[model samples]
Target: MTIREQLDALSAERILLLDGAMGTMIQKFNLSEADFRGNEFLHHTKPLSGCNDILCITKPAVIASIHQAYLRAGSDIIETNSFNANAISLADYDLQDRAYEINVAAARVARESADRYSTGAKPRFVAGILGPTSKTASISPDVNDPGARSVTWDELEAAYYDSARGLLDGGADILMIETIFDTLNAKAAISAIQKLLDERCSADPEGAAAGRYDVPLMISGTIVDAAGRTLSGQTVEAFCVSVMHGKPWSIGLNCSLGAERLYPHVAALSEIAPVLVSAHPNAGLPNRFGQYDESAQTMAGHIETFLKDGLVNIVGGCCGSTPAHIAEIARIAANYKPRKIPEELASGAAAKTVLSGLEPLVVDPAVGFIDVGERTNVAGSRKFLRLIKEERYDEALSIAREMVEAGASIIDVCMDDALLDAPRAMQKFLNLALADPEIARVPVMVDSSRWEAIE
Candidate 1:
């Protein structure tokens, strides 16, 4: 069945059960460096011991066994062992080139296992996990300069595209960008996924555009400390606003803070998120030795509060969780009903996500694009500059008016030129254009080359 149909069916249930930690379970097999190597890189110098994603290709049986354990524990959805499958993360082990191979192998293993365990009542699923790379996109590597970043936007887009393509090819039912410390990185990943969706729909080799990545999408972020914000310094609500544009099927917190510690942030997010909320907190706070102290039963009890409070629709364990933990979570979740979406959101009244003063942008779960016009730039348009230079304000205003008529949700204005008085020109044009009802409705982007003019 299509993923949309599966999501619809699952939504009617009290809650969906996501499997527990992959890294935690991988540690169960007492394998050394050579076991992780599995003949893929026997001659390589770098240590491949912690690179679990490679095991999906080198030790397929081990990965499949993990999936089966979760399925037996009653997990409705099993994420592929592809969290570090992207080129950026794999680069640490010098196996960056094998990104696609690793991701495809990982998904195929989970898909096969999920299919084998499928029953008529609760069919299993595979979520393509897009993990945060080792490097932060928004922060500067050099402490001296704050603006200098380690990774560029294009690099992130390419990395995400490679991972998404691999996951979609291997039959994943959903794309979950989890453990997000940076919202900018998540946006880059979401943009790549959206581009893949658009390309599939527009470039149909066969008669029908029915293709891969048509699965449900979920976005999960991490709360770093008691301050209740991500590592990027965004509060839970800010994180929600930053990612809600992607229209995720589910949005929640995972990793970082433990289950009980993350309760307030989860409750705060549920109030604003339009879609179903999910949470897969770690196995409580670590002890002095840096090990999870909570047992399977103890962790499940903490998550029970979220379910009873009607704050989440999906629940699971993160670090230090095993099949036993998942089994208990699945048991507790079955008794409580899923969090109900607000009636206004369900009835088509969106929470007013307005961009550029125009009508509110309808952000549906499946939408992938938004258009904004930049023709109002005097720097780019010689004719518009000449019209304004000639003091014909009315004629120059026509340019701005025409862009809105052509379906631009937002208009960009740039009055930066070496010869022209940019501040005066910008102020004059903005006052005139904003006064017109036709141009005033949409939002405006003030694009100026000079710092003074921008201010």
Candidate 2:
């Protein structure tokens, strides 16, 4: 059977076990800057001491050994050590040009390790880890300038495309976009991977028909704080609504919070997400000295609650977890059945027009009429148009806030004035509007006569 088929069949029977932390295990090696360089760049310009992704090239055996340990401890799925191998993140170490090489190496090492552990009855899968890069597309780095973006959507798409292609070439069974702090960044990855998959299908029709390129995608987001919102300020439902267009095989939460703190968010996802829900929280929160204090048994105790409640189809560890943690999780997981996917969701019967900004607004007849504030429309509101012309964006965003405060479920924004660059003005205003939580809690209706401005 193909990996997707096997995954579906096996997950329907019982909860799948994912591996524990790679960085935690790598820390045990106590390697130096020289070790990270591996004679490849002994006299390089920048310091390469703590770049863990580089280990796939510098110390393949070490990475493989870690994978083997997780597999031995009973991980049905092992993620490649390519978390920060994307061009954007690798630029810190001046290794941005080698992103493809690093990703390929990472997946190849994990692939070899998983293959060794495979059997007729029990097969292992490799999940190509696509970490949220150091930069974000939705949020502004400069607090003074809400419209300022550190990274563009195009840059993110190109970086993810290169990393994803390398992983596919190196034999990854699934692509896991994990620890997502920004929904827009995740969207970029989904778009890039979709493009790559379509290209592969076009290049090899026979292979596509045989399910050779039918790799599954698993998306997991991170809840930044106790409020249960991503760093981009999206609620669980809004985040799901934003990325559900990707048609992921599974969606869940990982990183940021520990198991106990992350439970409510995962529970919320399982309730509404049409796909399988997975959770791999950290081994409890960090201590004052910055370390995970939860033991294997303690962490497993929390995960047992998830299993008992039928909240997850896949469960495992994240930061600060070890092989022992995976063993305990695997042991407990064997006792519980996986969460069942909703029939309506699986059959496409639960489809609805759901709009979101930071919060979701389900447009249904049951919920009265939706009030769309049109004061932000430049063509309609002279004041809004004047504000844009004067470059007074901060004051302009206040108008959007006023609309939301006046009970507008959705804000209608338009920049169709001939004197203004409609597309540029629309983009700038929307970015600024989304930066404010009060305005972002409700959706925005992009009203534009120009298709270029709307797109």
Candidate 3:
């Protein structure tokens, strides 16, 4: 059977076991700065210490060993050690130019290791790790300037395209975009993957028609705090709705919180998400020294609760988890069946028009009318237009908040003033709006006659 068929068959039989933390396992090796550099960058100007992704090229054997260890621990799926292998993140070590090469090496290492453990009855799979890059597109870096952005969507798309291409070339069975703190960044990754699919379809129409180039995408987001929201200020439902357009193979929460704290969010996802749900929470919340304190047995016990509740189709560990933790999880997982996808969702009978900003707004006749506040529109409100011209975004955002407070389910924003750079103004105002949860909790409608502004 093909990898996709194997995955379907296996997941249908029982909960699939994803490997535990790659970073945690790498920490055990305790290699020095020189080891990270190796002969690959002996004379490079920038220090390369602590950049785990670099090991894919500099220490392939080490990466392979980690993958092998996870496989031995009964991980049906092992993620590549390419979490930070994108151009945006690799720029920190001056290896941005080698992003594609590093990703290829990472996936190749994991692929080799997984291949070593594959059997007809029990096959192994590699999930190419697409980490949320160091920079965020939706959030501003400068606290003083809420409208400012460190990275553009085009740059993110380009970087993710390179990384995805390399992973695909290196034989990854699935493209796993993991640890997402920003939904916009995840959108860029999805866009890149779609572009790849388009290119493949164009190159081999017959193969594409035969479903030969189809790849399963697994998306996992992180809840940044106890509030059950991402760093970009999206609730679990909003996050799910935002990315549902990508049609992922699975969606779930990972990193940040431990299993106990993350349980409610995962349960929430399992209840609503039409796709498969996966979770790989941290062993436990970190101690004062930033160390995971939960033992393997303790963590497994928490995961057993998820299994008993039938909340996950895939289960694993994240930060601070090891091969032992995965072994425990795999052993426990063997006793439970995977969560069944909803029949209505599977039949496409539950499809609806859902829009999101920081929250989701499902447009249904049963839900009553949606009130869209247009006071934020520059063309509609002179005061809002004046605020844009004067660069008083705070006051403008207050108007948006007031609209939501006055019973608006969606906020309509338009920057169409003759005196303003409409696209720039729209981008600035929307970025600032997204930074404010009070305003972003409702969906946003970017109203513009100019396609550039809408884009």
Candidate 4:
């Protein structure tokens, strides 16, 4: 079913409940490395330890049972056990080639369990998990060169594409990109998902599954701390704007913080984001021993405030949460109506005339006169135009940095040169420019005389 159909079916309730921590439940099995391998890697040398995603293929019963538990506990959504099933994360166990196999099996397992418990009253939906990998794309591994990153855009894109292909093949209803710490990394995943959608629609004009529904997309990020910013140094609002291109089904904060600590940040998203807001925080702050001691009742009590105030449409747990915690959340968070997407936000008016680097350049009449860096233009900087013609995106980023340092609040990115593929040039330069904190910390004004580039 499409996201709208699911929502219409469950229209009686607000705050569609999502399942709690997959890692926490996976630990309950107490499986060994051999169990993780399950004959597939029986002869392999490298340890298969900490490879929870592989359990979908090896320990199908255990994984399905976990999904069953969440469904019984009143969860409307259950995520696939493929958090680390991508090529990047699988390299740790030397099972990179099995990334697609791992994800397909994981999604299939979760789908079966969700279908078993699905009902006309409260149908279950499977969300394919796209995790934030071990590497950071926006931060430099080498402090000496701030622009250096551990992962390239293409690598991240490829991993997400492989995982997404497998997830869809196994019948997932939605794609959830969770625990996002870097907005650029999240962008790569989102881009890959869009690519999948384009390919599917192109191959089958009616869409996969004969036009039943499009796989709804959802993105959840991490606040990181009291700073109220992502690990990439973007405020909650800026993070929302950075990934706005994805046009997610829902956007909110989750993980790294407990229910209480996550409240304010979630509230911020509810106020600003142009989509449904969802939050899944940890049970509570870990104690000195690194154990989550927050009881299920206490966690539910805290999450209740969000429901009472209508700040979230989806709520659940992250670290150290279980079915019992989800049960309490489901019991208390019912009857409340889903937070309505404001007519203005759903119309996407907030997306226009805004270049968000560190903060948004909100181009409304209320703001002061904005300074747009016009030097990236052919008329202003012959060197910039020349570099664009040659496709030197790296050098192009340097020019953008200079423009930001020159006191411009918004970078007027013009890729309208006839010699260039305007759309490709615009996408390349924006990807590079937005990855730079110096440029990303402000808004970007996409300028083009050609409608193709503007679109």
TM-score of each: 0.79, 0.98, 0.97, 0.86
Task: Summing lDDT over every window of 10 consecutive residues in candidate 2, give the lowest-scoring window.
Answer: 343-352
Give the alpha carbon lDDT tens digit for every residue of 1-455 in model 2.
88899999999988999999999999999989989989777878999988999899898999999999999999999999999999999999998999999999999999999999999788999999999999999999999888899998999999999999999888899999999999999999999999999999999999999998888999999998998999999999899999998999999999878898888889899988888999999999999998998999999998888888889999889999999999998988899999987888778797778988899999988888989999998878999999999989989999999989999999999999889999899889888888899999998889987999997
Query: How badly does each model clash, as a count of residue pairs?
Result: 5, 0, 0, 10
User: After best superposition, candidate 4 residue 274: deviation in angstroms?
Assistant: 2.4
Weakest 10 consecutive residues of candidate 4 by summed lDDT: 4-13
> lDDT of candidate 3?
0.91
Query: Cα lDDT for residue 449, model 4?
Result: 85
* Per-residue lDDT of model 3, residues 292-373, tens digit only: 9899999999989889999999999999999999999998899898999888877779888888878788899898898999
Model 2 / residue 18 / CA error / Å: 0.7
**lDDT by residue (tens digit), candidate 1, 171-241:** 88899999999877898999999998778767765523454446688999998889786776667776777
RMSD of each: 9.4, 1.2, 1.4, 4.2
Can you tell me which runs of candidate 2 are displaced by over 4 Å?
none
lDDT by residue for model 4 (198-315), tens: 8888888765666543777889999777978888888988888878789787887888889988888888889887778999999998899888999999999999988888888888
Question: How accurate locally, in lDDT, is each candidate?
Answer: 0.83, 0.93, 0.91, 0.85
The candidate maximizing lDDT is 2
